[model samples]
Target: MTTTAEHVDSGKAARKRVPRSGHARWLPPVDRPDPVAVLERQGRDRLPELLPIRYGRMTASPFAFLRGAAAVMAADLAGQPHTGLTVQLCGDAHLLNFGVYASPERSLLFDLNDFDETFRGPFEWDVKRLAASVAVAARENGHPAHRAHRAVRETVAGYRTAIRRLARLGELTVWYERVDAAGLLPLVRPARQPRHLGSSLTRARRRTSLQALGKLTEVVDGRRRIIHDPPLLEPAGAGDAASLRKIFSDYRSTLPEERRLLLDRYRFADAARKVVGVGSVGTRCFLVLLTGRGAGDPLFLQIKEARKAILEDHLPSGPYLHPGHRVVAGQRLLQAAGDIFLGWMTGPQGRAFYGRQLRDVKGVADVAGMNPNRLLAYGRLCGTALARAHARSGDRIAIAAYLGTADTFDRAVADFALCYADQTDADHAALGAAVVAGVVPAAPGV
Candidate 1:
C-alpha cells in the first residue's frame, strides 16, 4: 500500500507549477490500493472511541448515528483497490454534505458545506466515500443494488465529464462560476408523489438565514443572544464572555486590517453553549451572536472545536505545524467563496477551534427526494465544483489526464462503494449493540 506521505509528495509535485489555464497541461498521477483488505481492516476495530466526540446531540436524529463511523469506513476502504490519483479531499463528501450557502458576496451559491476532515490526501478517497454513501442511502430507502448502481454510475460519470469541462475553462472562469440556490430549484423540483421522507431537501432549500436559525436565537436588551438550553446551550458568565471578547480581539490579528475593520462594526453580545451536528457532539461549540447597529441587524457566529485530523495519526505531517491551521488553510484554499469570518483562535485552555457564521442561507439537496435524472445532475454539479477546488491547489491537467476517458474507474468505485455500504450497516449495528450492552450510553431520541 502507498503511504499517505508518499502519495502527498507525488500529488504535490505532479500539481506543482502547472499553468492555471487551458487543457494542454499534464494530469496528476492516480494513487492505487487494495479495496477488500481496506474494508476488512476498517471493520475489525470500528474505532468506537472516536464516536463520543463525533456525535453532537444524539437527540437530533438517527442520521447522526453515522457521526463516529468514519474510523469504521476508513478501515473498510483500506481493503479496497484505489486509483493512485490523490488531491485535497473533502474527507467526508456525502451527498448531504454538498449545499447552498451565502458566499462572502452574499450570493446564494452551492458548494461542499463541511470541512472538518479536509486534507491533502487520496483523491479517490472522496469519490469512493461519496459513492458508498449513495449506496447506503439507497438501501435505507429500499432501493435495490441495480437501481443504486445506476445512480452511482451517473454520479461517477458526471464527475468525470465535469472535470474535463472544468479543465477546458480558465482559472478566472472557474472561480467566478457557481451554481446558486435559485438555479438548483428547477433541477430539484418537489417530488410528484410527495412523501414526508423526502421533504427535508425542499425544506432545507427554502431555508434562509432568518428562517433556519433566527427563532432559536435572539437579541436581548440590545445584545445578540442564543437562548440557553442546558447541556445543549449553557450560559457563559461575564468573566467567560469577557474572555471570549478578548479572544476575538486576538483573532482579528490573523486577518487583514481591512477585514478587521469589517469585524469591528459588531459589538460582542451574549454567548451561550450550543450543541451542533452529529460527528461534532462532545467537542466544545458555541454561538456568538454579534449585534451591529441594532437588534434586527445581527450575525450568529459559531466557534467549533478543532482537533487533529483523523488522517494525522495515519500520515506524516507536512509544512503545516498546527492541525487546526491546516484545516482552516485547507478550507480557504479549496473553497472558492469561503466565509468572510473564517478564522482561528486558541482559548484559555489552549484548545484550538475555527470560527465562522452559523447561518448564511446554507442549505443542501435532499438526496432521498432526488430522482435518477436529478441525482445525475446534482452529481455533475458536485463533480465540477470538486474539480475546480482541486485545480486551485494542484495540477488540473495532470489529474485530468490520469482520469482519462474511462469508466473502469467508475465501476471500481461502485464496487468499493457497494462493499463499504455493507460495512456501514454492520458498524451501525455494532453501535446499536454497544448501546444495548450499556458500554456507551445512548443519547435520548437518537
Candidate 2:
C-alpha cells in the first residue's frame, strides 16, 4: 500500500507530465471526424424510426447538443494529455445529470442520476465535462462570457475544496458522505438561490410510484393498464409482454435475497414501451408496472438496454463483460445511496439490460430558467457532490494534491470550458446544416 506522502508525490508528478495550463488549449485536429458522421454512426443500431427524434432533440440548443454528444467530447478529450489519476467517471457528467433522488432509506439526496456511460478514467475528464456544461448553460441563459468563466471556475473550486476535505477523512466516512437536498438550502445565498427550488423539491417528493399510477395508467375494462400515447408511451405487444415476464426472474436473481423477497410480493400488472431522454431516444426501453397489497398500491420499474460506454472506445476496457452488469456495478460504487431494486439481466437475442425504479422522488434543476448566480450555485453544488462520489472509489489524497491550494487548475478548466462551448456551437451548427440538407431526418418539436 502507498503512503500518504507517496500518493501526494505521485499526484505532483502528474502535473509535470500534463501541465495544468495545458488543459485550456483546444483546436480540432487535422484528422478529426465529422461531428455529424459520429452521430450517424451511433444511430446505426438504434431504432430507425426514433433516430429522427434523437437528432431533433440534439439540434435544439448547443447545451442540448453537449448533452447528447458525449461521444464527440469523449474523442476530443482523449486526444489530449491527462493526469492519469483514474476514477469511476460519470462519463456523461453534465449539469442536468446531477439531481435529487430518493435513497433506500427514503431520504432525498442530490447526486449524479445517470450512469449510462459510466466508466473508469482519469478524474479530470468528469470535471471538464461538468465545467463545459456550466459554461454552455450560462451562455444559453444570456450570461456574459466573463460571468460564464466565473461560474465554471467556482465549479472546479467546489470540486477541489470538497476533495481536499474528503481526503482527510477515514474510508468509511468518505463512503458515507452524501448531500442531503434539504440541507442544501442553508448553503446558498438567498438572493442567488432560485425561487423554484423549494417547489421543485416538493414536486419531487410527490413523484412516487403512486403518483405515476394515476398519470401513466387508466382503467380498461375493469383492469388497470398503461395508457397508450404512441411513439412515446405505447402498450407492449403480446410477444414483448411475454419476454418481459420471462426475464423478470433473471433480473430478480441479481438482487439481494431480501430485495428478491420484496420484489416477489408485487404481482406484475402491465408493461409498455417508453421513449425517454434526448440521447436515449432510440434505445430499447421498457417500463413494467406491478401491484402490491391491493389495486391502489403500485411499483414502476424500468428495464433499459445498456450498450458499451462511449468512453470505452477512448479508454482501456473495464472489468465487466456484460454492459448491464457494468452499469449496475458502477452505480453501486459511485452512488452514496443506491436504489434497493437495482439489478441487471440478459434478455432475448442476448441484449444487456439493467432494471431500477422508474421514479422515486426524482427532481432535476431547471437550468433554462436559472440566472447567472443561480447557475453558479447549482454548478458548485454539482461539483461538490461529484467530489464526494469520486472520493468513494478513487484516491482522494492524490486528486487533492494535484489540485493544490492555488486557483491555477480551476482557471485552466474554465478556459477549457469556454473553448469547448465554442466547439459545441460549431458542432450544433453542423448538425443543423445536416438537417437542412436532408442528410439526417429530424422530427422537430417532437
Q: Considering every candidate listed, which one attains the maximal lDDT?
A: 2
Candidate achieving the largest TM-score? 2
Q: Can you write out model 1's per-residue Cα lDDT over 130-178, one digit (the tens) per residue?
A: 7777767666666678877776776776666666676677768866656
Reference-based lDDT, each prediction:
0.62, 0.92
**Lowest summed lDDT over 10 consecutive residues: which window, candidate 1?**
19-28
Candidate RMSDs in order: 7.8, 1.0
**Model 2 TM-score, 2 decimals:** 0.99
Per-residue alpha-carbon lDDT of candidate 2 for residues 155-220, written as tens digits (9 for 90 to 100): 999999999999999998999899999887755435544455787789899999999999999999
lDDT of 2 at 186: 59
As for candidate 2, its clashing pairs are none
